[model samples]
Target: MTEPVSISLTVNGATHDLVVAPRKTLADVLREDLGLTGTHVGCEHGVCGACTILIDGAPARACLTYAVQMEGHELTTIEAVAKSGELTPLQRALTQVHGLQCGFCTPGIVLTFEVWLRDNPDPDEAGVREALSGNICRCTGYQNIVKAVLAAAAEMRRGAGA
Candidate 1:
């Protein structure tokens, strides 16, 4: 048995002081310790983007990260996306366009593009496709997902102007 290590993790703008095994992945710590299950675990090998989350404002696979390694970093999960109980533009667009089916990959896709859209407020279809390449969806064929991303980008740009 490994010794439990105490670490502080700031997730979703909240700081959590927890004692977890050193080898425990950030995904487990978030879901099990912090009850933030929005960060899903798919492949556990980092190939699938299902466990994607933001680490210091960048998308990273929570399953590939150790909880202890995130001591000083700011983590953002799917739970933080719609914090105000209202859907984000991306969320709304996804729903309106039917971008998801099983929804197992929705959180990761949403988290990935949430940050992506911030940097790329005016992305084209190719850019959106490249950005979405990391996430794998067995349900939707990615047509609607692409449309939703483009729609969200347009909507966000308009909102920013307002």
Candidate 2:
């Protein structure tokens, strides 16, 4: 058998050096080796966006991206989004708006929209829905998610202008 490939990458602000198979996806490395289960794997086909993560400050598909390719890259998972056991404004907005139900897809939605929110802190409802099209949610029918995004956006805008 071939030897495992050595990879060095930063995850959630922590440096990690792991020996992983070349075929191992970023999701596997994050969940299995790094003990970060927040990045879930749903379709595993890159369509679900359940394994979405921030690579170099951009949203990426962890399931479709191999770990070997992530060398020297910085990854941001769901755990990183929450600081000191406190939810971010966006996360809190999600809760306030009741955006999540089963919570299986919440992480992906959070990570995915987080990038968009940062890039566009003041987005309309249609824009928010368009940005969220990549992430699928079976519960709440996405109306609550849209509400949460809009609320968070409005809050952030107010803060930025203040």
Candidate 3:
């Protein structure tokens, strides 16, 4: 067995020090070591995008990334997307548009759209659909998800978002 490596990184605005096996995926470290279970494991590989998280403001699949490689990096999970106890424009829009059903994939969708919205704050429906192609949600059939993203884009453009 390989020795566990120690890492210190910021998660959701908090610093964490953890020791994990070298082969431990970032998804495992988030869900197990850090007690942040928002990142889910679907395929265990990077294909499903179920374990998406933001690393230094870029969307990354936590399941495919190693915990040891994240040392000193800034990570944000679904838990941190909302600030000051307020839902983000996307979250609010999702609720308004019924973007989620089972919610198993909502965390990944949220983080994915969070990153997408940063660059495409005025996204059209087609643009939103293209941006969400990576996140696979079994429920909602992606119609409402696309609607929510476009709606959120409008809300964000109206100055309801950061």
Candidate 4:
């Protein structure tokens, strides 16, 4: 058996010191160890964006990342998006537009767009589709998702201007 390695991970603005196996994926460490189950594991493979999380402010697949590799890196999960207990504009738009169904892919989608919308406050439908390509949603047919993203972008832009 491989010995556990102690490492410090900064997640959601909090630092966690944990002893985990070197090979354990960040998804496992986040969900099983840290109790942050919002980052769901879906294909286990990197192809599915279900395990997407932010690594140093960029979206990355938690399933493909080893926990030990996260040391000194800033990680953000869906749990951190609405830390104030209120839904973000994206979350609110997703709900209002019915952008999600089943919800297995919602967290990843939300996380992806949270960063995407920051970089692209005025994205068109094509750009939104491209950004959303990484996430696979089995339900909702993506129409509502696209609408929600556009809606969120506009709402966010308005919020920024205000």
Candidate 5:
């Protein structure tokens, strides 16, 4: 029998001490252990973006990271995207523009767009598509998703300036 290893990690600005198996991936920890089911599991081989989470503010494939390996690193899942009972602009924009359908990929899409918008606050249509090319959303067919990102970017900029 293998003993569970104790490790500490910072998730969404919260620190937690967790007992985990060495073989347990970050995805399992976030979903099964931490009860954060927003990060989906698809193509566990790392090709699909469904399992993407922000590790230290950058998108990472949670399935490829072991729980023990994330010690002391800051992890941000979909739960962190919302703060103070308010949704992030990108999340709200997605809903307003019909950027999501099945909703399976919404979390990843939100996180990815959050990062992209930070770098390209006023991205044009082509730029938005290029930035989001990494994520795959079968339901929205990319049109609404792109529009949502653009709208969110503008809103975010306006808020930042205000």
Candidate 6:
């Protein structure tokens, strides 16, 4: 057995000191160690975005990242997307557009959209689709997902410009 390695990860703007196995994946660390189960694990590989999380405001495949390697890194999950007890514009948009069905992919979808919106708050249809290429939604067929992203972009833009 490998020795437990200590790591401090700032998640959702909260710092957590964890002692974990070096081989533990970030996904496990988030779900098991930190009890942040919103970060799901689908393929246990990098292909599926089920285990996606924001590392320093960018989406990353948590399943592929080691817990020990994330020391001092800022992590964000779906739970942290909201601020001041208000749903993020993306979250509101998803609800408004019925973007989720089973809700299994919602966290990853939210993370992906969060990152995409930061980069392109006024993304076109094709741009929205391209940005969500990595996040697969089996139930929604992606139409609502696209609509949600676009709607969220508009709302966020209005809020920012106001």
- Tell me how candidate 4 scores on lDDT: 0.95
* Tens digits of lDDT, candidate 5, 84-136: 87988888888898888999888887888788788888889999888777778
Per-prediction count of colliding residue pairs?
A: 0, 0, 0, 0, 0, 0
Q: What is the lDDT of residue 47 in candidate 3?
A: 79
Local error of candidate 3 at residue 29 (angstroms): 0.7
- Compute each candidate's TM-score over C-alphas: 0.97, 0.95, 0.95, 0.96, 0.92, 0.94
Residue 41 lDDT in model 4? 93
Model 3, range 35-104, lDDT digits (tens) per residue?
8998999988787788999999999999999998998789999989786799998999899989999998
Order the candidate numbers by TM-score, best to worst. 1, 4, 2, 3, 6, 5
Q: Candidate 5: deviation at residue 138, Å?
A: 1.6
Tens-digit lDDT track of model 4 for 1-162: 489999999999999999999899999999999999999999999887999999999999999999999999999999999999999999999999999989999999999999999889999999999999999998889999999999999998998893
Lowest lDDT sum, 10 consecutive residues, model 1, at 39-48
* Cα error, candidate 2, residue 33 (Å): 0.7
Q: Which portions of model 3 show Cα errors greater than 4 Å? A: 160-162
Clashing pairs in 3: none
Tens-digit lDDT track of model 2 for 1-162: 367888898998899888988888999999999899999999999988889999999999999999999888889999888778977778999999899999989999999888899888878999998999999898889999999999998888888883
> Residue-wise lDDT of candidate 1 within 4-75, one digit each (tens)?
999999998999999999999999999999999999999999887999999999999999999999999999
Worst 10-residue lDDT window, candidate 2:
1-10
lDDT (Cα, tens digit) per residue for candidate 6, span 1-162: 599977788888898988999999999989998999999999887877989999988899999999888877888988876767888888888898899999988999899888888888788999988878888778999999999899999988898993
C-alpha lDDT of candidate 2 relative to the true structure: 0.90
Q: Local distance difference test, per candidate?
A: 0.95, 0.90, 0.89, 0.95, 0.87, 0.88
Measure candidate 5: CA RMSD. 1.8
